[model samples]
Target: MKLAENMLFKYGSGKVIRVLYINPFTSIIYVIDMDSNRWSYPIPKDDFLTAYQNKEMIEENDDIYCRAVPEEELNELEKQKRDQAWEIVTFFKSKLSDDEHMFISKYRQKAMKETMAVFSISYNGLKNILIKYFKGSQTKCSLIPSYFRSGARGKERKAGNKKRGRPRKNGENAGVNIDENIKKVFKIGLNRYYYNTRKNSLKTTYELILKDFFVKEVIDENGVKIPVLNNVKDLPTYEQFLYWFRKSLNDGKREIIKREGTRVYQQNYRAIIGSSTQDAELGPGTLFQIDSTIFDCHLVSSFNRDIIVSRPILFLIMDVYSRLIVGFNITFESLNSYSGAMVALANSMTSKKELCKKYGIEIEDNEFPFCVPNRILSDRGELVNGYINGSIQNLGIIIQQTPAYHADYKGIIEQAFNQTNIKILPFVDGAVIGGNSKRERGEGLDYRLKSSMTIEDFTKVIIKSILFHNNHHVLSDYILEESMIENNVEKIPIRLWEHGLKYKKGQLRILPEEVIKTSLLPSQSGLITPKGLSFKKMLYASKYALENNWFQMARIKGNWKVKVCYNPTDLTDVLVFDEHGDGPFKFSLLEHLSMYSGKGESEIEQIKNFERELERTGKERELQEKMKLFTEIEDIVKEAREKTEAEKNYSKSNSRRLKGIKENQKNERLLHREKAKKEREMEVILDESIEEEDEFAMFRDWEESNDDE
Candidate 1:
């Protein structure tokens, strides 16, 4: 290799040197030892070339040997040091001429001392700066202070009997050395007092340590227990306590979780690495976030306007890339169950035309596009179920469940809920405002009583809100791609979605509506009984089952179980998949159970419970009535037996008593018929007599009035 200035070479013994100056006229080279930052003796050019050729010396890249620090990473002190060094080096170089430069390269003590005095820098400092400048290719960054290496990071120092750190001032006693025993005490105190939800400050924890570990209780002469502190000189100081506390609990996450509650820390204190859309999503439909929140307003029942239905749970599915709310479901179903999540997911993958039409809202196809996402992110709620995971996976969709207590993982949907509420809730009647404390203090009218909108009406309003959000609402903080900017696309959800479809396509997968419904609908095992398909204690029938005589076969061969999928929000029909690959078919409720036709799962359960309670009460009343009738029969039997016992010695033989039994029975029946006819005649005569008396009295009063006139 050709020798040049600032070139590095490593000797056979592994000592590295940088070429400071090369003199072709004298056939000599000047270099400096990089490790010691000192000048080395001059070497003959021929000898150096021989060593390099013989493999006794190897050429090294200066970049590997020289340290370069970024200016931004430098602290104030480091920057000042670097500037000072650069100024000194610049002044020294300005003073040197071409002749003096070569002379100084040979480590001339007289010239170096004179220059150092002029520059107000020590001789060694000047020499070190010169070595660094040449070795680092004369870059200003090479002079940055390496204070990071000053304290010997990662190197443990053994503590001596003397205190290791700075001593106290104000004539205070010097603190004792912290040994293994003292470290143990510090750990115990920290664990007991500091790392807990109590949130004790460092000083409070140190005081607690002093009180508990460094003080002893003594009985005074007055028979009172008094606390006595240990010698101040022998006790560990507060600084040592804090230092060891941080060192012992070095993991930030663990410390946060211990200091605060896990839930609080995760919700408030945990570091957010990056947004899901920017960090993980590629384009629209690549990733979707699904979450559910309780709606802020109460709603009236659609059937009974007087009844107030509690707040409905709003399930939203938003595209992570475009922040477009692809689908949503508003229902009374709770967020804990997978029912609402499944419905929301199914809605997300299917067309929203019917949904919008049902709510009487019109929208274009492009306004709310429905497409299956490659991955769906959700909290550890509904979508975290094993069955849901399997079902979604079968559709070639990946399920990403967020860590426990980490709701921010699906923050896109969470934010959408908040935004939707903020836009519409203010105008809605019965909207929940402020915290529960306000309600407890009776600040306003009862929200439940003020509710006026039904679920359907509220759903329509939400659809309108969503439409506005998708098409017209501007996303001020939305990040745009270079292509979007070039095309002058507006920062709106619909525009972003349209652009994504045109440019970044293929992330969206479209399946048939029926397929998506069957896959995402919540499923449960139903029994095929003689009555019908028994599910949730409700009987259902299908045309296929009727034609195949499934019920008839079940009647003969006992009931069997099969997996069935159903929409919990509407239990009128369920889906049963055929094992022989005929596809899933709908099972409608049996005609005999028409009362439960439009009822949901929870409503049906409640109705069944009410009916059961009624049956139990009716059975109890029937038992009481039957007991009273039996008591009357017993009384009649006793009266007849008493009359027989009172009769004097008059006994009829069994044959005599039985003789003419048929004739006697006929006579008795005729007499009873005659008696009933006479009683009916008397009742009719009495009613006629009462009517005639009233008529005669009216006539008499009219005649008297006429005579008086």
Candidate 2:
């Protein structure tokens, strides 16, 4: 039979088949014999047609060319051939064209055998196969998907026309091709074929025919199969496909393929917030607290007996809940008494802004507000309580000293202090004792007091250092606290509670006041006392308590001695009556007065001022009553004088009424009338009044004489 001639298809001699025959008819391919005798034995029609049809098919409108190599260079040439084969196979699996895909799948298998013969078999082929099955037409290079789906189309065809937003095209059929039969049938157009078969041909063919073919599996150096043998068939039959998928997900071959895109080894980590089981026993501010010891690095000051150089102590209170440090203090001397504890409490209670300013740190206020710890847990060191048992009592915070020699109880802050002293500070040269001390000495012995490189500088160092340590140090393998917050991604502790709020839901949780109270009281824990509970021979207490019981505590000397208070309920209103209840033996005014009297006599002056006002008001009342009585008597006397003058009708009285008659009218008749009337009134009234001695009597008598006639 005469065949059509086409230059594009002609290789060495014979003319190729008709253009229409160049379809996915792979059944026609064969390795032909060169001898003329083969012409008598007619070429197998299927094989001949398969070879002619697939060869004639051109993809991307490109011509096929073979690279020629010398016989001696076959090994190297074979390697290049296998690599080219892998590329072609990958491209083939990506749904480029039906005829081209079939051609590549055939040659890729051939390349695999050749590669095994001449070089190490590359697993890239197997990777390409798996990617084809799973990744599918999800990539842009998948020609079938590119032809069917437009970039301007919405994610789905049924959706309404998209507005200004960019459109999405699905890549579901990326690495799969149209089935040979489906392609042949579709050559007639979309009119007559079954829609389901047309849509799913590529996927179906990939799963059945091409799935295992291109995945060239072989043995490795360890003699283990390349694609690990997981009996996917043996997985739970209930959800076999899903089980197989998961098994395939963990398959060795998939892992090998995945490894190619990344480095050979990498660390995988996740940091999440978690609570300690021990936290259940501890209250909000209960349990062991820790801090660093700032020794008097100056050997001279430390060695000297007379001139004392105080070693600053860092006191950290750990809130067992979130394993967070709730309160802390930096001081030259330790907390050994109530006063020091109070100062530490005051420092802790100060505003976060003040802490930030003193320490030179930036903190976010929203997340990490300054924390007020309910209790302080620390080592059995006097410094922790500021060397005064009563120091921290007034602040209403409980003081708990861990057992002697048990460092693990305070491990949280202890580890922090160790890191501060050993790791972080060591990076700084002056952080060492000698170095810091000399520098500090250059400033002065009282460096912290001057606010100028003296006391202020020392104070600043501590404040800044604590800030730096708490907010900047790494706490665990994954978590770090900048200030009061934990940060995992930035890998630094947030200096303020605000930054820590991201982890708030995890770490800082709120508990009711009753829970805290219940945990603190005797029926619950019975931990506190007026003299304070005796533990390891030390006394601790809540400040307002006075009863000496298992819970009541007192500050004696420098130690916190727990004097068991008989009553726990009488914390704020403990009444200390003397031997007799009569008069209540009140420790009121004098006792209250004596405490602050030495500081300044201001209280005494206030009392004196109050008493003077009281005396002045009393005298004024007496004078007011006397003045009223005198005024009433004057009114009665004036009435009587008028009555006598009217009844007498005397010529002298009429003459006296004239103006300027006072000197001329010294009438004896008027005087006799006035005397007789006065006598008659005195007899009627019988008025025996007490003798009146008035300093104004002379002035009154002179005015009276001048007015008289």
TM-score of 1: 0.54
RMSD of each: 25.2, 37.6
Instruction: Please write out the lDDT profile of model 2 over residues 119-179, one tens digit for every residue.
Output: 3445564434323322211111111121222242222223232322233247221122223
Which residue runs of candidate 1 sit more than 4 Å off their true CA positions? Answer: 1-274, 279-282, 298-311, 331-336, 355-365, 401-409, 427-430, 437-461, 482-488, 579-582, 592-598, 613-650, 683-699
After superposition, which runs of candidate 2 have C-alpha atoms over 4 Å from their true positions?
Answer: 1-277, 280-292, 299-310, 318-326, 334-337, 358-368, 382-400, 423-453, 477-492, 495-709
- For every model shown, the clashing-pair count is 0, 75
Model 1 scores worst on lDDT over the 10 consecutive residues at: 65-74
* Candidate closest to the true structure, highest TM-score: 1
Model 2 C-alpha lDDT versus the unseen true structure: 0.36
What is the Cα-based lDDT of residue 557 in candidate 1? 91
Supply the TM-score for candidate 2.
0.26
- Specify the highest-lDDT model's number: 1
lDDT of 1 by residue, 1-709 (tens): 5554556789989888877656645667877777785555678889989999999989875335444222223445565677688777666655655422633544356556667888778867787776666555454555656563444322445778667778778977767877788888877877888888898888998899899988889999999999899978888777777676665534566668998768887688753433455433356777888888888888876655776767888888898878889988777886756889988899888888866875677776678988767678777787867667756754546677677778777766777887898898888887887743125564666666788897668888889999999999898887788999999999999988878766664224554455667667876778889999999988999999999998999999998877687887668888885433234678999889987775667656656766788899999999999999899999999999999789835578877877999999999999999999999999999999999999999999999999999
lDDT of 2 at 47: 56
